[model samples]
Target: MMDALFITLQVILAVIAVYQFVFSLFGMYRKKKKAHFPATKSFAVLVAAHNEEQVVGALMENLKNLDYPKELYDVFVICDNCTDGTADIVREHGIQACVRTNTNLRGKGYAIEWMLKELWDMPRQYDAVVMFDADNLAAPNFLSEMNDDLSGGARVIQGYIDTKNPEDSWITAAYGISYWYINRLWQLSRHNVNMANFLGGTGMCFETKMLKEIGWGATSLVEDLEFTMRSVQKGIYPKFNYDAKVFDEKPLTFKASSRQRLRWMQGHFTVARRYFFPLLWQSIKERNLVKFDLALYSVNVYIVLLTFLMTAIMGIDAAVFNGPNIANIYGYLPLGLSFVAVGASILTFMAAMALEKVTFKKVYAYLILFPIYLISWYPITFYAFFTQNNKQWSHTEHTRVVRLEEVVQSKQV
Candidate 1:
């Protein structure tokens, strides 16, 4: 009976791993097709910056170059408690920019909320409200694509975010690969199947009415995720616009990466604790299994923790629990199947990378270093759980300058 129970447990985990692998494969295929939407309406481009003077100038330049009517789309920059010349730089560009300073509310979420409130009070309502970080340099046709998606009945749209500095260091390369894999496999696959896609902090466009109806307030450490969950509950699944692109810098140092990831993990945990139960209950009450599946998947940190614990327990069982005389109770079949599941997962990841137009030469270099990069996250995840860290926004420095010419050159080589 004990042997049977062990086999059953292994089978369950293998099944889950297989399911995830298949989902990733689907994403690999769906990423190749570009979904083009027609640009038909006006938009409000909103940015929240805090001590980001270095990149604000270039960001404004990128925004100014977007293929949208200057009169139809307005750029609003909220300089949240910036001690630098962030506001002055925007003014220097001869653009109409709003600068808000608040030392009390120091987070990007609060800054965005303040700006949204101010915009809401205006006599004219924009057709769509687009959100982006100050460091992000949007593609020239970003607004045009998002405008098309918005007009095509998409309540919320999420675009692809690629790293602007993949060659800077190993850390940046790993981050770039992770971002590429997510955009190609996770987001693309989920969207192809009509599953929910989460907002990626920047490069997201939302219908003005939906934004206002959802209160346009962000209080969680991960306001984007919290807002996404709330939007899902209201029957709005974020749509993925493949052609809408945003380029941003990845952390060059491990310390900076850990700090940024820790905040993200903490915010994810906080959102899970606050909303998972409520969403699960609502899904059950309304008989909407799809939403329940999304809510459960949205809080994926628990799965990682659970998998680690399970693997550790299996290791201990092999070393400490099993008697020398007793034949290994858990059959090798289950163990072998588990490894197969892992293999399939790796294949799915690689397949997704291929679909994202990642060349074999580049992927080979990343594959050799992927294990070390993945292991590094374990320490960060551990610290995120145990540390009683302040929830204050931890900013990452972005110094990389990437132009379209550089990207084109890399692609050719």
Candidate 2:
């Protein structure tokens, strides 16, 4: 019985680790296709602001200057519970603004839901809604690419995420690496096999009708993840548009990064609690492969935690419990499996850096520290789920105001 349990433990870790290691393989075959815009489709550009006075103006200016036809899209800013000049800035730009000062409704999820409802009551509506954080600068051709995707019959689409201040600090650099890993492994990978991709909160779009029917009811700390899973379960898979880019500012400090990541972990745990089993059931019942894929993706962190926990269990059993000695060649597969994950993460980080044009000389030292940062996720993921209360939203501040021209110039140099 003891030997059997030992082998089973290694097998479990081996399976999950191998899954993650091979996951990026899906994107290896993904090819970027040039966008061909058939016609200019109308869009409602929605900016969700929360005390973002420092950078909202720049974003509005960037949106106003999109290379696409100006008449086809209108910028609408949502000043939800702002104690700053966010609303005034929006009005100054001659764009429509909605100020919601209710202390009760907060977070981007609530703000977006409120704005969608308000837009629904208007005399006219848009063909699709594009969402962005106030600190994000749209690439000049963003809407043009999205227009092409929409014209090509993509109902839900997610634009690529680029960092405006990757060199601001080590924290931001780590964030940039994580973003690249997720963009390639999950978004681009899904795009490769014609699978549905997910929205990354910002740089994502949805058809007006889809939200109306669904009601944008994703009110959580990680509402973006919630909305993505909800949409996937409903047979709506968001496609990834590589040409449409939104450059967002990353947090420059560890406190802000922890706060943001904790919110994501907690929100992801909560959404998994609500939808994991149902998604699996629906996928099987309806023969939906996308839903099956998401069912796996939703609980991935938990799966990692479980695998890690088993490794610890093996260690404890060997040391204290006097079970099978994990250090022995008899049962070292768990350790080997773990190294597989670490190696994959390191390679993927470099791959992401290469794709984002990050120089090896600037980020090589940070790459050594990258695996350590990922290992920290285990504790954060656990803390988010087991010790939970006061689900009110908390957000990271984004004041970096790097413009597209500056980023382009920096890249050229």
Candidate 3:
């Protein structure tokens, strides 16, 4: 009876996975409609950098060349406890860069909060505030599209972030493909159905007033997720804008990738424990549909972890009890099918790539190794929950650099 019950729950979760897949497909269809709105507002572009001396100059150059008028957009770089020349490079270029040193408050979230406080003190009131990491290179039209979305009544907008080092190594290639698929399909789908979307740390724009009302503050390790969930709970779902693109570097080496993934895993586990119950309770008490969405998004990491555990248990059962020792045929069949379904779901990343118009030739080489990358998260996530190492922000290294002209040429063919 216990085995049957386990098998039943597996089948039910598998069905929910299928539902999410379908939801993603519909999102892709809806994304084809161009986001249209007038651009007649000013913006404050906030960049948080820590020891990014090598790439800060280039990022400033890219910001200078943005298509938006200089008077309309102001770029602010916060050098949070940097020992390097990150602040020097930005200030050297004549940009308004601030050097902040706080031993007590350390992390990108704290830096952002400080910057927000500075903005509030000034007489200037920006229509929107867009955040980006130090390494990201914005497209010329990034601000223009973000302005459109803000004018169209979106409180928050998440732009697409593509990798600059996709062709450098297999690890980087896999990471790049996963990012592209998620932004183009998963996020686009969720936005289409009015569901909450996870905020990719950089390239997200928030309305100035909304940020003020919500209070721009995040001390959590995964400040992006915490901020996103809080916004959703308040009934402000972030809109996805695929037309606004930001290019960033992928971790070139496995050591670097592991460190980055470890932080993400730890942050996810922390947020799930912190917000899951509150969101669930809020959903039940208020009968709020968006509250339920926020709760589901918060618990996704746990769900993935659960799915992996259940898969392992069923695999053991199939090997030991399927042939002669057990007469429970129903238990084996459903669990076996569940494993197949899970395997197939992992392949959906490939399908998502095809839908995004990423060339099959460009992605085929890394396809076979994709599953290995997916499974790697299991160990990191497990360790994150158990050990919880480095709750403080450990920024990933970004050395890869691709020009906007290169990205345009690649897309042209």
The 0-to-1 C-alpha lDDT of every candidate, in the order given, reads 0.77, 0.80, 0.80
Best-to-worst TM-score order:
2, 3, 1
Prediction 3 TM-score vs. true: 0.90
Clashing pairs in 2: none
> How far out, in Å, is residue 37 in model 2?
2.2
Instruction: Write one digit per residue (lDDT tens) for candidate 1, span 1-413.
Output: 85565556566656666666677766756445454655668898898788788888878888888888778898888878888888898889876567777776778788888888999899878988999888888888898888777777898999999877777777778888888888887788788888888888899898998887778666666888888888888888888887788987889887898788888877777788777888888889999865786677665666555556555667677699873322233354578865775677677657666777765355457577876777766666656666524577777777666665566467567
**Tens digit of lDDT per residue, candidate 2, span 1-413?**
75666567566666666665576778655585565865468889999999998999898888888998878899889988988888888899998878988788778998998898898888878889999999999999888888888788788899999778877777777777888777877678778888878778999888888888887988888788889888888788889987688898988887788888888887888888888899999999999888987887788767766756766777788789887654433344577765766677677767766765665344556666666667778777777777445477886787887778987776566
Task: Summarize candidate 3's per-residue lDDT along 1-413 as a digit string, tens digits.
Answer: 76666657676666677767777675557446665666688999999999898888888989999988788988999999999888889999999878899977889889999999998888888998999998888999999999888878888889988876576777878888899778867887777777777788999999989998989666678888988888877778888887889988788777788889888888888888888899889899999767776787788778777767766666776788673332333455777785776666765676677676775355568777777888888877777777565577787866655666776676556
Per-candidate total of colliding backbone pairs: 0, 0, 1
Off by over 4 Å in 1: 1-13, 31-38, 312-335, 360-363
Top-TM-score candidate index: 2
